[model samples]
Structures are given as C-alpha cells and as structure tokens.
Target: MQKIAFQNELTISTVQQRNGANNTKKDVRKIQSWLTLFAMTNAGAATATGIDGDFGKATEQAVKNFQKAKGIPQNGIVDQATFDLLAAPMRAAFLSTITGTDLRGLVVSAARQHVLNRPFELVISQQPNSGPWVRAYMDGNEGREWLWCMGFVQTILDQAASVVGKDFKQLMPLTYSCDVVGTTGLQTGVLFRYNQIRLNPALMKPGDIFLLQKTPNDWVHAGLITHIGDDFIETIEGNTNDGGSNNGNAVLSRVRNFRKSKLDVFSIEGLV
Candidate 1:
C-alpha cells in the first residue's frame, strides 16, 4: 500500500496575536483559518482577513467582532481565552477519552462530535478542498486532489481506537482511497456487500465503515455508520454536503437508503 500523505497532526497553539510585529506567525495563520471557518459555519458571524498569515487591521477587526459576539472582552487581540474559543472544535475532539467495550459506540460518538463541530472545506488561494479541517483530515495535504472522505473515516477510527489502547491501522491499511479500504476489508474477510446486507441487515452496526460501491471492485466513497434503521442507515461523513456527493464539502449527518444505494460495509468487529 502507498504511504498516507501529510502526517495526521491535528493541533492548534494558544498563542496571542495583535496588529503589529506578530503578523506573519504560524499561529496567526491558524487563527485566521479558524475565523474564516467560524464565519462560514455561523450565520452573521465575523469574517476573517484574507488568511494570508498577516494579522492586519481587517484581522483585528474580525477578532474584535468575534469577541463581541461571544460576549467576551472586545480587546481586538487573540488572548488565551479568545484563542481557546477559536480552537474549540479541534480541541473538543480530544477533550475526553472514551472507555468502553462498545467500540462501535465510541467510534460513533467521535464521528458525531466531528459532525456537530461542522468541519467544512474552504477554497484558499484559488485552490479547492483547502482549509484547516481539510488539511487536518487529509494528514497535511489539502487541495483538489485530496478528496477526504476516507481520510475522515480513518481519523475517526484512529481517535476512537487510540482511546482504548488499540490501533485501527492494525485492522486496515492507512489509506485515503475508498477502493483501497474496501479491498483490504475483502482480503481480511470483513467486507459485507450491499446484497449481503440487504438479506441480513443485522450484520451491520454503528461505526461500521460504509463504502459507496461503484462496482464489485470499486468503492467511490466512505463514511461512518451511526444508525441502522429499518431500511435506511444514518451516517456521519466528511468532505460532503447536504447534496450527499462523495466529493463535496463539510462533515454532515445524512440518512441513506440501503435499498436504493450500493453501499458496502467494512466491519470493524475484529479490531474492537
């Protein structure tokens, strides 16, 4: 298998920022990115300054606006308190360590947190699929080439497994390709085709990775199953929006009908 590009380093620094001198700091870039994301997700929220890693007047005014909306002091500077709120979503993912025999539940919880946090992509520098969340999920690389559906699934699995002293990589190859993940599941005797699931829906469970199958040998998209209903399954998937395209934007919770879609399941029972 090919190596996973861009190491999965999802973290933010608690550095303070102001208008002058600290303009080109790396943390400034992160703050700008968060400000942009916050503005995008929250309606009527403060927008960011161009995300050019420069803490100019526009960035300061945006920060002040954010502070005012949050009911904090509108000091126009990113102090520890302000930075904490800016990085809350990323921090929320690692806030608690899940402990339980229900590995599926744990994974589902992780995926839910991500969806609630509203991870979405932002076009940067005329490039698509670029942003803090996209870069974080895709390891470090983010662009048009990096469709991050599988990347999000892998990250959620890893997060849940690591909390219980287990490693998901032991069960499946570290990959961003749905086809690669599906192929590995087949080799490991864990892949359940849509037809199999159609006959026995009980075989599927929460946290089981779902792959939208294009062919018997090709899987196009991936996501984490959160609920298995009578004829539909709920999913928390990334790099997708409300339209449910595989290569879209945002982490969203969607209900998909198994009877209508060719969705395959990769059981993580062995890993748990």
Candidate 2:
C-alpha cells in the first residue's frame, strides 16, 4: 500500500477559527478530518469530536487534549511540531514509550506459562473460566458464565506487563470484542490484516494477535501468537484447544496451519 502523508501544508491560518468564525473553506474541512484521525489514532481524544470542519469548542478541545498528551503548549493551536505528531503512525506512538531488554518475549512467555489447563469442552459447566487455574484470566473481564478465550488473551497481556511492573493498557487497550479491536486497528492505521498477502509465517513474531475473520467486519475468535513454524502457527488460545474449535472450553495450545485456514494475522511490531 502506498503511504499517503497527512497534509504537511496545514498552516495555523488554515486550521484556526474563532468560536463564531466560518469554517466553510475546503482546507478547513480537510484539516478537521485530519485532526479527528490524529486524535483517534493517538487514543486520548474523544471519538465524538465531529469532523464537520466546524472549529467550535469540541474541535478546539480535541486538539488541545491532543497537544497536552504530546507535551506541547495548550494554546489550542496546531503548530508544525503538533502537525508532525499527527502524521506519526499510531503503532509507533503506542510502542514509543515501551522499554525492555526484549519487549517481544514478555507477552509470549506469559501466555506460554498457562499452556497446561484441561478439559476444553464446549458445554457450560466445563468452560475455560471453570478451572481454578485459569479463572484469573476472567478476573475483571468476565463473570463465571463467560467462555473466556478473549479474557485469557487479555489477562496474559496484562500479566506480562505486570512482570515488569508496567501497565498493559499502555501497550494494548482492554476489549472483549475482537471485531472492535479489528475495526479500531483498521481505523487508526496501526495494523494491517493479512488477507490476499497470505503473509509468510516467517514474517511474523511473538506478541502479534491473530483474528479468525468469519466475515468482512466480524472477527469471531482471537489468540496470542506465541511461536511460528515452517507451516503452522503455535498459539495459546483461550476457549479452545488442540481440537481447533473456536468455542472450546479451556486454555489450550494449538498449531494452526496458515496456508489452510482463513485466519487474519495482525502485527504488533511496534505496538507492544
């Protein structure tokens, strides 16, 4: 895909507008959409900020909040430095502050530690959250009724962060809906879903997340990519097992063949 730069010619006069000023110019409209994209990508600005090209308080406040996050003066102005930050990739921003001797191993190692739980049945009584060993995976995310694969993945991420006494939310946001993560990744330009590319298994690394895209916008299942082999991917997935059922009932390690399955792999190269 060709990289399209966000407008570099965004002048202060081009984006600035008083509370009662008219923002009908085409340039102003482009800047408003650009700002909205920037704010959403950076993760602090509210998504409700309408990209209507109206430089009202909402847009002003959104830009100001973004400026504050970037440690720029809160003058509600989009200067050159601030505009450059807007053009920066979200994946880089998310991982820019992450520090460790080996950042990639943290999550994969944390997930590998939980590879031995049992009885992955699809029935309600024997789900992934049923076992005392894996119950903690669902601690804050799910009640007893939860199936727990997504919870397991979420827990492992946070647990890895805890090993270094750092918060995991800085690396990845907490979410139950795999589709939302997929959607947000696409929207924020942080990740690209592997489809036609049939991404080579060697190209992937640990800490990446894989989504089972059952439909165009629907992601049915997800897991942590612990290791990759010549033809298969070794994954530690919740609510599943060696049987490969997406709705199974335990935290299990499974090897899935990339060439045979319709899985979409998303890289977290600089996102963890």
Candidate 3:
C-alpha cells in the first residue's frame, strides 16, 4: 500500500486553518500567495520564478500555455486538474478536510440550498431531455412551460459536485428499481401513496447523488445529498411543479425524513 504523505496532510490542515481564520483581504491575499507557493513546489515547476498567488501576468500566461498544451479551454484560470497539478498536496488536503470535518451534513445542506435557488438551466445541451433548461427557467423569476424532474436532478448534482470537489459519478449510479413505482410500496394514511424511488436516500452522505424516478421509468431526476437528518433528508431539486402560475422551474424542497415517506426508498450504496 502507498503510504499517505505527511506533507500533503500538513498542507491541507494549514489551508483549513487559514480558511477558518477571519482574515482581512490583505491577509487573505498573503495566504493565497502561500497556497501558490505550495502548488508550485508540488508541481515541480522551477523555483527560479518566484511563487506568487497574484495570478499575475506570468501565472496567467503559464496557465494559458498549459491549457493550450493540454488541449483544454485556455481560459487562464487554474481549473480542477490544473489546480491539482499546481497543488497535489492541496487536493489531498481538500479531500482530507472534508472527510475529517464530518462534512456530510454540509454537503446535504449545500445541496438543499442550491435546490431552493433552483430552476437554473444547464449549459450543456446533451441533457436537454434531462430538463436542465426547464429547471433553470423555473428557478428564474419567470417560469417556463415544460418541466422534467430528471433534468432537474442532473443540474443539482452538477452544482453539488462543483462545490464539494468530488466526482459524484464515482459515488452514485443513475439507476432506480422498476418495482417501486406509485402507490404500490408504502401507504400514507389515506393520502399520497409512495410513488417514486429516487437516488438511494439511505446510502446518501453529504455530496452523494440523489435522483428522482418517474413512475415506470428506471432513472429520471437527480440531485446531490446536502443534509441527512434522523428523519428527514433535505434536497435541492430542480424542474418541479410550482403550483399553477409559477410552475416549471427549478426549486429546492425538503424530502422530510425521506425514509418515512410513503415512497419506497432505494439506496445506491453498493452501486456507487
């Protein structure tokens, strides 16, 4: 087994400590510079060029040049991979920080918050059937005509992944059982019968993918698990029915103690 590097751990701890500190802009800039230095060292770039976090002309040029060489969009910003290259230790640190902080709740909470701000459209066109565009429009002040629950889920997962820096693809699968559809599984008094089996609510930790399955369909909607309470699991969903007038938008809603809901709960734990 590969030994965990102490330097990597230390770097992440330092970043966390700095983030926790209520520093002024100047101090924050200083910390950023230090981060850049750390990234440079790990990347094995020459130290002849001073390590500065300013993202100045030289850094910007370097980033653009690197992007061109790698066939990535030359936007000059250090994206995830570029960031990883510059600061492998920091990436390790970031993952450690999340794991150590018991950040599962944070992830769930963040996802919930994103959902509340929902109805946002996704930039990619491939997921049109997923209803991201409809979700985006719904989240907007003006609602649209069509809404697709599956599309809504995709947008939320995408946003959650960006915030948490984890590949959600690795943690969750886009599959729902066919048997758990409408009114068959659980009964809620005389009212709503359990209908859909979305992303496995049981297997969810912070940042895990939560999905919504339409009746008869295997996999439909998607979201990120932001919070998991004893009884309730809050989600940031998109492209939902918002009453009559403001319908067809992305919105965040809580799936109260999802396990208790009349709906059948299927977890993607083993699948992930």
TM-score of each: 0.90, 0.54, 0.34
Measured by lDDT, the strongest candidate is 1
Cα displacement (Å) at residue 16, model 3: 44
The best candidate in terms of TM-score: 1
Q: Give the TM-score of candidate 1.
A: 0.90
Report the Cα lDDT for residue 87, model 3: 40
Q: Model 3, residue 209: what's the lDDT?
A: 43
| TM-score, structure 2 vs. true | 0.54
Off by over 4 Å in 1: 1-19, 97-101
> Which scores greater on TM-score, model 1 or model 3?
1
Residue lDDT tens for model 3, 1-272: 01122122222222211223532333223233333343333364321222322435564555555456456786655433554444443333223322224334444544444443223332122332222134232232112323444334433343334454555334333312222222221222111223332243344454444434345334344444556776666555554434311123335564544654433333323222
**Worst 10-residue stretch by lDDT in candidate 3?**
1-10
Clashes of 2: 0
lDDT of 2 by residue, 95-209 (tens): 2343335546877765665553232222212322432223345443333456566666766666566656666555456766678777766766554555542654555677777
